[model samples]
Structure formats: C-alpha cells, structure tokens
Target: MTTLVAIALVSCDGPTDAGAPDAERFEPSLTGSAHVPYSTSETVALLDEHTACTIDTYETKIDCVDSSGATVGRFGDKGEGPGEFLSPARVIRGPDGLIGFSDSSRRRFFVFTREGELVAEVPLHMLSIFVPISFSETTVLGAYTDGVGRAFFSAYMGDVMAAAEISLSTGDVVREWKPASVPEFPECEHGLPYYGFPAVGGAGDDTWVFMGCGPGGDTTMLRAPRYVAESPSDRDVEEYGDGLREFRRRIGADPDVSASVREFSETPRLYFLLRGQETFDGQGRLWISTRRGRMESSFIDVYDGVELVGTVEVRDRMIDFDLFDGTLAVLVERQVGPDDSDGVPDRGIDWYDLGEF
Candidate 1:
C-alpha cells in the first residue's frame, strides 16, 4: 500500500550542540581489531546477532563473516549477469533476516540468504540517489530523491524530495510520498547548499533518512509512512534551479551556487571537509555521522525520532557505519596508497561489540 505524507524540513543544531542536556556522549574503541579489508562499502547490515554482511564494491562481491571473525564467504562478483553486481551501492539485512544488495549501476536488487547464497536478483527502475530504506520480496521502499532532473539537489543547495515505493518484480514506482517540505533551506546561505547529500540506513523493514549537505548539524531525518524532516530537494520553492535565475541576473549564469553563495562563498561543502554517512541500530534508532571539524575521527549523533538521545566519538575516519542486534560494523577510511588489482585505496570494515545501547 502507498501512503502520502507531508513534513516540513527544519535546520537543526544537533551536531553543533553535542553538549545539550539530552545528548549522551561516549568515545568508542577504534583499535585495529576484527578488520575485514576491502569490504568497506557505504552500507553494512547484520545477518544475525553475530553474522554481519557488507558489500566489497572494490571486489564487486558480498562479504560476510561469523561471530568468530572468520570469512563466511565472498559471494557474487563483477558482472552484469544475475548474482553479479556491476555497482553495489547499498547493502542491508531484510526483515526476514536475508542479505539484500542494491546495485545502482545495474539497477537490480540482489537477495541472498544469510549464509551467502543467492536467492533472486530483481530489477529496479531507480537511480543512485534513490536509496532503499525498507526492502521486502514484493517491493522496495526507497527514501530520498525521485529524480528532479536538477544539476545537483544536495550541496548545490537542495530540492524537496519525494520517497518512492517500487515493485521488485516489475521495477516500477508503485507508491511514493514527499518525505519533507522545507519551509526554508536547512542552512540558508552558509551550509545550505553544501556537504549535505542524502544518507539512508535501516534495520529490517524500517529505514531512516538523513540529509547532510555540509557540516551543518542534523538537517532532517525521515521515515515511512512519514517523518518530520528536511525535504530532500524541492520544486515548489521560488528559488527554482537553486536560485539560478537570480544568480544569472547577478553572476551571469555561472554556476549552481544558489544566489547568496556568491556574496558568501563560491563553493558548497568540499569533499575534503566532509565524508558523511549514516545507519541504524537494532532498535531502529538512527546513527548519523558528522564532524565538528576536520580531524581523524567522526562524531556520530544517535537520534530517537527528533530527540537527540546519545552520541559516539569514533577513533578513525568513518566512511560509513551500521548497528544491529547490539553489534556495530563500520567501514573505516584508511589510505594505503594504491592497489594494482583495483584503482581504489585499501579499505577496512571494523566490527565492534557495542552491546546493549
């Protein structure tokens, strides 16, 4: 079934004020232990209380491990064929306890058993920005953009986005909802049109969305059937084309830097300043990664709905992270120069026993 919801996206000071009265703080262990190298895809999910699965986009395969940190198996490979993934964008454990991989380049959803066995690979009509928040055999409920055809919806400023529920067998959007309506851009002129790209994470049938364009704290977090969040990218506002009409009037159609960034800064959020991502705990609480400043580690904010419940300071630069069943799997960004086998740097997936949060 499809549900239509309306929400207003608001700018938050969550990350800016980690010392708030409601925020619980901690610094987790970041030692080099239980490292699964080259399997640090942007997403991770748990198959069981101990078994965690993630995509090695570097190797173009599924990487799973048991409770003892042993290689369960490396399933799938680089191919356009079934059970093969051309570009595995996101990986999640389904409600039925199966591993699901979203291959954006191939536009197919691959389903597999927790034991690394392939079940089915269904096609999807969505693009890279449309992230599957909730997955099942029949349909995939994706959060974030629904193809506004804008030059850039996020750091180039944003457009309010509508979430879609697509069919698995047919690869069609069967249902959808506008996740949020931004009465105003999350950060007006400063981080408004920067660093924030949409981030999606989930546990089982539940999915959570975060819009982090710049270093700005909590933009908006949304979920289906709906959430009170900052709309992804919107077309309803007067600043269509991210204020290009006025920008061209002022700067001669130069770039998509909204209209105000010229008077402020000419750029959105730089990649060097922000490498942001998100995930969810077993209880379906949201874990979003943000940085207070350019540093070695990441500061993660845990939100239960709109309430800031807890926060964690990691030891390494976190590329992406996920939490389920009291276990946390983080894709840590470690530079090892280069790899001849692949053109990317060496990556690692660090597993932690963060029991009972």
Candidate 2:
C-alpha cells in the first residue's frame, strides 16, 4: 500500500522567507530536558527510531532499544553467519513498525521483528547496484511497488545510491523501474554522488517522497522532484533538478537557519556532504536536519505536505533522529577534540513530546 503525495509545486525562496507566516506562527512546541546518559558498555553508532524499536550502532555491533529507552537484551552482532550484519551503514524503523538495517559491507538488507529477532535479509543488487538503506523507520521500505524506492546517497562505487521497492512482505526487487531515473544533478559531478535519507509523507491514503542531497561540506538542501504533476517533458526533470539545487543554495546561505554544505572526501576522486535527514510525526509535520560543522548544529522545521508550517531552533548538537506515535527521539554526541576523549560533549537521549503539536 504505497501512496505518493501529490504536492503543488512552488518556487522556493531563500531562507529569509522560509520562516513561519505571521498568522499561523505559534511558539515552538518542542521542549527538551536531557536525561542522564545511558551507560553504554561500549560506544554506540548513529541512532535510528521506529514505532517499535530504536537502534544505535557500534563499530560492528548494533544495540536495539525499546521505546522506553531501555536496552533490549538482543543485539545485532556482525559476522558471516545468517542474520549477521557486516558493516551495517544504516538502521531504519519501517512504516509497519518493522526494522530494517543495510549492511553495505556485506551487501544485504537485514529485516528484524520489533523484538530484535531476524526475519529476512534481502539482497538488492539488480534494482540497485548496491542498496544504501536510509530512512529505515518508515513503512515505505516495503510498501513501494512503483520502483521509486531509494535508500542512500553516496559517491562511492558499490555503495547503493538509488533504490526502488519490490514488496513489503517478500524482499523482492521491482524490475519494471530499472536503473532509477534520478533527476539531472550537476553538483554530483564530484566523484561521490551525495544523497540524504528518505522522508515520507501522506502515509496511508496520500503519500509522497522527498530526499535532499549535496556535495560534502556544502549546506545546500536539494529536494526531490514533485511527483504529482503532469507527465514531465524532457526539460521538466532537468529544470526541476536545477530548481532544487538553487533552493538548497538559498537555504544553506541563510544565517537564521543553521545549515551548511559540507565537503569531506573519502577518496581522491570524490567529496562528501551530509544530505538532509528527516523525522516525520505520525501526522503532517516533518523535522529535517542538515549539518554545518562536525557537531550536529541542526535546525528544525515543520511541514504539512508541500507547505512549510513553522521553523524553530534545535539548541544542541545531534547526528540523527527518529519519530513514532508522536514521540521524537534524537541522537546527540559529545564531540571531543581530536586528541582527547574527555572533551567530547556528553551525548544524551532526548525525546520530544509532540502529540498535541
């Protein structure tokens, strides 16, 4: 049951104009009081949330936490065995509340029950030369049959950059939509084609997809194409891609908004940037993050379908976030200097109570 939101396209303005309109502007409903750090026996990986599970990664092991922020006894350890994750890159909580993790190093999709039990590990070599799974928390992972499903954005060869869905029940590839029809991206000329995690909207009946990408170190936020329009002529897709690039440039340049384009290259042929990541409340609002520096200096915005509802300042350093049943959980790190671990800003688990908002 994949539903794509039909958005009415609008010319994007720079961030100076991206603020809340005077009429509907309400004080930021987000309030945060940090909790004591969960004493991790070891360091954790990036944080991902879903309806039933929240996952964090270590170098090779993954910790599964329940909604209460309590660690589940079952953890994912990577190895050659079945259900093992080898270099798991992303862990997403799906729309059906199922959990999905991509093992880029191993080239497989590990599907787990809410209880952290392994169910299936599907491979996506045909639809995607490699599947870089992002946004593992949404239901779209299995619901998309249109072949527009995508997971990650990376310039690295063998890194699954583009993906479309086959089915939710059985991990199958949609053969109809072959070699994903990505819009014209001029900025991806660098060795690494950058992409962000997937943001899904219009859940059950009306749904749409939005992804932001960029060159590393650039604070630009290029959005995905508006899929609800009439059949795009040859030029439409090109123009659409260009418009998104410009929109990203605009928002990245704004001072009130904490966004930037990052440029870190893993290989000589390419550079990298943090693509925009998202947290969608069960309803219409969305919380997106783009990075300016190494620290998680992120800005928050609320969106209903294509309309920007409100924007606010998220006062802390964060790397990733997840939302489910109206609860918003963020992953923050205490970044220490290169030489010393003592100064790493103490990281905590923070959840936003947004049911009424």
lDDT (0 to 1) per candidate? 0.53, 0.41
What would the per-residue lDDT of candidate 1 be over residues 205-264, giving only the tens digit for each residue? 222233433232333433211111233212113223434453354335555645553433
Q: For model 2, give the RMSD to the true fold.
A: 12.2
- Once fitted onto the true fold, the runs of candidate 2 whose alpha carbons sit more than 4 angstroms away are 1-59, 66-69, 95-97, 127-163, 167-170, 174-199, 203-276, 292-297, 335-341
Compute the lDDT of residue 196 as modeled in candidate 1. 25
- The TM-scores of all predictions, comma-separated, are 0.65, 0.56
Tens-place lDDT digits, model 2, residues 28-108: 344343432432211122233322233334345455554455655356775878888755654565545555666545657
